[model samples]
Target: MESPKIDIITLVENLAYQQGTKGEHGLSFVVRTSGRQILFDTGQSDLLVQNAKKMNVDLSAIDAVVISHGHYDHTGGLPAFFEINDHAPVWLKSKAFDEKMSKSTGTPRFIGLDPEVAERYRTRFRTVEQVTELAPGLKIVPEIGSYYGFEQPSQSMLIKHGKTLSADLFEDELFMVFEHSEKLVVFAGCAHRGIGNICRSAMSLTGCNQIQLVLGGTHLKGASKGRIAKTVDAFRDLQVEHFGLCHCTGLPAFMEFSRVFEEKVRYAHVASRFEPFD
Candidate 1:
């Protein structure tokens, strides 16, 4: 059977020209492919829900929901999603429950997933510690592990490991891949594991070098100049043809991306749809 057409729609973001739409400090994408629809990362709040409603995007067709990490900004819409998605399995890393927080030279705040909410949807949760194929052409990848690249985890975020405070290794971060024909289209939510790491891992997962498009948050906000340069180099080395960058990518880094990738670097905001093929 021929592969079903793949369509990605941005339900929430903090960028671009979608009139009469609202933006947020979060990200969410609705994936439709292979006779299945996937909701990738619920935005900060009901922002995604409200936006989808405004755009007349139906949420009832969602076959599954994949969370990128344990951060509140990414997983806060769990309640809203649960109401609309029927009982689709919530996919994420097994460590999604880790106590997370950030200390930015001020009072540290809880940035982890809500225990009460997770408990409520415990039966519908599907945690994966390794790569798992959700369908014929869709897969949820686990941790990207260590990569000695310029894309490093934020130093401010920390995880509570019992009585110890451990640096947030972002073990909960995961990226989704959609394979069509002989091409691979990758989506990284927040990409705390590093874009270079994500690209390398995506190639490894698909076992092919032909990446159709690299979309979603790169989390490169406020990155150093040297780091950004090396990251763009990695993109070039990997031959990433298109990038749909948005959410926390920062103006400076995004500008660099646009300069390097030129027309290949399109900002994905509210109502932005990406169909790499045809």
Candidate 2:
């Protein structure tokens, strides 16, 4: 039997591929498979809606919305999304609403979604606590554990507990897996939990070793040389066939990946379209 053709259109990203489409420091994708349209992440603003309009994508037709994590850059367009689509349920992990902070600049800055939006559109959210099948052949894998100590969570990210702050383990982070026979197509957002860990989790959950393609942010910006080397080695060991990385993956890591992966790597910019099963 032939596998279903999955069409992924980049609705928002850090780089614009087309002239009319604008770019921002965020990520979003329109994934079409099994006769359904799934909106994966909504970038950081109304740029999602604007880019969708420019690219001829109808937000009103989305069957579901999957938020990869609670970061504002990934969930900031929820208000705009809900303003347009009234039926599609927004799926996310329970901890996605926790107060997330970033201290990369030595000054704590809030990076979670807007509380007002979360309150106003509370009814639209469907928080999942475990592995869930969103649609036929489409699974949402959450609570990714770090098997590799080198793939640790960023120490600069914190979760605010009232006044005290602690390292954000990113329990709210999740990744999407599209099963196609013995192969899998993984979609990650920022990959705050680590891309290698995300891939391993997907393979373990689905029991599939062949990752046909991996697309999304890796959060490897400013990562240590040792970390990048380990990640590259991990990907090679995982046998990932293709990579469409972007956003926070960082130029250094991208260059290293391209140099190592060669023709197997491609930058997934705004307006980029990927048909993994084609």
Candidate 3:
């Protein structure tokens, strides 16, 4: 059977504009294809609900929710989300339960999804710790058994019972790769799993090195210029033709990628949509 063309709708993002300047926190995207609806991740706050309301996206009809990782900014809206649609299965990594931290100042923070919320969804949702295929053309990246020398590991922590500890490179961090027509589209979260490494493993899983489009956060905030440049060069090998970078991608890094990729890189603004043709 031939794959169906994929359509992505950006319902929530950190940079949402209500009228002029004020905005909310977090990011959320919806992917629809083959008569199924999949939500990539929920933003850090309830703006997802408000955005969906304003944008007219019905949460009740969504089939599944794929959490990139367990950061509050990405999974914060789950409690509110569950209140609206309690039946959709939630997919995430098993190790998403870790401490989060600040890389530059080494400050501790609350970054994991609410345990109460996660536990509540445990009955209806599904969690995977390894590379498991969820549906046709969709798979979750297994745990990071080893961290290759692509880039320095992320500096974050998960707060539990008022105790601060080094955050584990949660193996639960995963990305999705699906075939749209003849090309592959990668849906990533914060990319806590090194972006380059994620691409490498995703390629290994799909047996296709050519990525036509990439969406979601690259987590390149505060990245060094050399590292960003090297990443762009590596992308040349992957032949990524389009980019929809948003959320934690940071302004400076997004501009850098745009400078290099030109028309190929398009900023994924809040309330945006992309239609990939077959």
Candidate 4:
């Protein structure tokens, strides 16, 4: 039997794929599959809702909302989303509500989800610490086990617990897996735990090696050339059939991927639509 078609429409990203749609340094996608609609990430502002309106995506019909991590860029639009959809449960990792910070710009800045929004909609949030099946074929897989040495977390990322601050290990990072037929379609927000690690986790969790598509950020922005090379090698080893990379994947890394993967890779920008199963 053929797999069910999975249609992914980019609602927000750092670049715009269609005219009239604004872009921002964040990510959001409306995924439709098996008669269900899933909102993946909410971007850094109201762009998700605004773009969704322009694209004719009905936010009120979203069956569920999956947040890849605690970063503001991915979770900041929760308030806007809540205003429209009141029933869909927001799924995220256990530590997704913890205070997150980034010092990459030489000054510490809070990067986690808004405390007010999280507190206000606490009842609608569903925190998951392990592999969980949100629906029949949709699974929320947390980043677990070991990580490749080359895929280290950025030192500038920090997590705060009231007064104490520590390195952001990104334990809250997770990815969405859509199992169709015998193949997998992986969706990530920023891949803050490393795209390679997330891919490996998906393979290990499902015992399936055929990843028909991988869409979303790889978090390779400003990474070392060597690291990018190693990541490319990892992708080659994993045999990911198609890559729809965007956001933090960076131009240099995307260029390298396009050089290697060629026709199999694409820069998925805002308003871009992808049907991986097609």
Candidate 5:
């Protein structure tokens, strides 16, 4: 049988302007194709399940869950999620369980996912070392090493290993690649590893230069003007078709990208749907 065309829908995000469903500082998306329906990033709380209920979405039907990283804002909903769907593999990086914390105020704050919850469903977790194809025309892109100069690893986010704290290189950050309309569409968790890095890694892995859409968070909220401008210029140079940006893409950066991309950019808020042929 021929592969199915992919359709992605933003189920829950940090903002919900018109969806009636509540939003929080997190992200979650539902990617549907003919063979498998995947849930990407479960948001910061059980709110994902609540919002899915409001949208008439059946969480039990999800074939698997693709977590972006170990951050709670993206993985915190797993406990509640697993409750709804008795069983489904959670795909993430191999070392995704590493302890992660942030010290923005010079005081450590836990930013990683709940360990107790993850331990409870450890059997369902799938550790990915590199790019792995989940199904025909669908793949999980993992650990795209840094390639851009401006998008350096954050010092605030730290990981503790054997009494040592080092910058969280975001080795756990990952993205999904799906073939649709003969174009490659990227479903990013948070792009915690830089959007350019992810796009470039995807191209290198798939050997495809044309990216149809880059959907989800870019984590560019706190980036400098020069960096944002350079990023926009880079995408333009890449000839990217559409950008469904949301979450950590700060207001200023988003506006800059909006001006550059025009109607090709849309806020990937809760309930936003990305179906090319629709």
Candidate 6:
């Protein structure tokens, strides 16, 4: 069977854009394929709505919204997004814990979303605690645990008595997989658990060893050169052709990846777009 064509629109940025252009923190992508509209993740703010409006993306028509994790950066726009449309199913990992944090500097805050926001979708949002296929070729792999000697802890986010704090690292991250014609387009948020682990888990779920495209943050800001090199070698071995790295992918790691992957690597900036084929 022929695969559905996918169109991904970048809705947020972590760095400055063209001259005089500003950057938005966090990440989000609208994946349109197989006549289905999937909102991957909402950035750290409502810039996604603005970007979507700029790109002529209609959120009201979105079939589903998947939260890669519970970080404020990724879920901050949920309240606004929900205001736009409340019909689509909000699929999230059962353990998708998000907490509030202080704005100044960066400190552990509260745990979970604000009451105002939670009330909006309290009855509609659904959580999937296990690995399951949501559609013909789309599957959600929930909390693969940890990777890179780290448990992939995310900040506990919440608001308490008008104060916010970073909560805890409750296992809440997930990755989305799209399989078409035996090719895989894996979508990740921060990839806190480790990009390699995500890919391995995806392979295990789909039973397809080939990863054609990997787009999203790699969470390698503090990674050492050796670790980055190892990651690149793994991608090379896996034969992933298109890599769209952004957000916390960091400068040093991205530069090294570009040098190593060359044509295969694409620095993922806001407004960056691409289509993968085999």
lDDT scores of the candidates, listed in order? 0.85, 0.92, 0.74, 0.88, 0.84, 0.73
- lDDT per residue, candidate 4, 211-260, as tens digits? 98899999899999999999999888886889999999999999999999
lDDT of 5 by residue, 11-92 (tens): 8898896556888889999988776889999998999888898888899999989988889899989988998998789999
Query: In terms of lDDT, which candidate is strongest?
Result: 2
Clash totals, every prediction: 0, 0, 13, 0, 1, 18
RMSD of each: 1.4, 1.0, 2.7, 1.3, 1.5, 3.7
**Runs of candidate 5 exceeding 4 Å displacement:** 1-3
The TM-score-based order of candidates, best leading, equals 2, 4, 1, 5, 3, 6
* Per-residue error (Å), model 2, residue 79: 1.0
The digit string of per-residue lDDT tens for model 3 on 1-278 reads: 77677788887776765453224456788888778888888888777787788777888888998888878878888877888997898887666655554544565545677777777667856777667665667666764423346655565433344563554555668888776555678887877667767777767777786787788887788777876777777776777878999877888878888998899988787877888554
What TM-score would every model get versus the actual structure? 0.95, 0.98, 0.89, 0.96, 0.95, 0.85
- State the lDDT of candidate 1 residue by residue for 1-278, as single tens digits: 88766888999887636766798888899998767888899888888888888778888778888999998888998888888777789999878899998896676778889888999889988888888887778889886855545677999989987778779988889998878877888998888879889878888777888888999888888789888888888788786778988897888889999998899898888899998877
lDDT by residue for model 6 over 1-278, one digit each (tens)? 57565667676778646443345768888887778888888786677777777667898999898888776778787878888987888788755544434333455444345546666677767898887666668777785633344424433223333443334344677899888878788988988777888887788788898888899998777777777777777676675867888987899888888998887788777766656662
Q: Write the per-residue lDDT of candidate 2 for residues 122-224, one digit (tens) a residue.
A: 9999998888887778888877867677888899999998999999998899999999978999999998888998999888888899998999999999999
* Weakest lDDT window of 10 consecutive positions for candidate 5: 145-154
The residue ranges of model 2 lying beyond 4 angstroms of the native Cα positions read none
Those runs of model 6 whose alpha carbons end farther than 4 Å from true positions after fitting are 16-22, 98-107, 110-112, 143-170
Please identify model 3 stretches exceeding 4 Å from their true place.
Answer: 17-23, 101-107, 143-148, 156-164
Relative to the unseen true structure, what is the C-alpha lDDT of residue 9 in candidate 1, on a scale of 0 to 100? Answer: 93
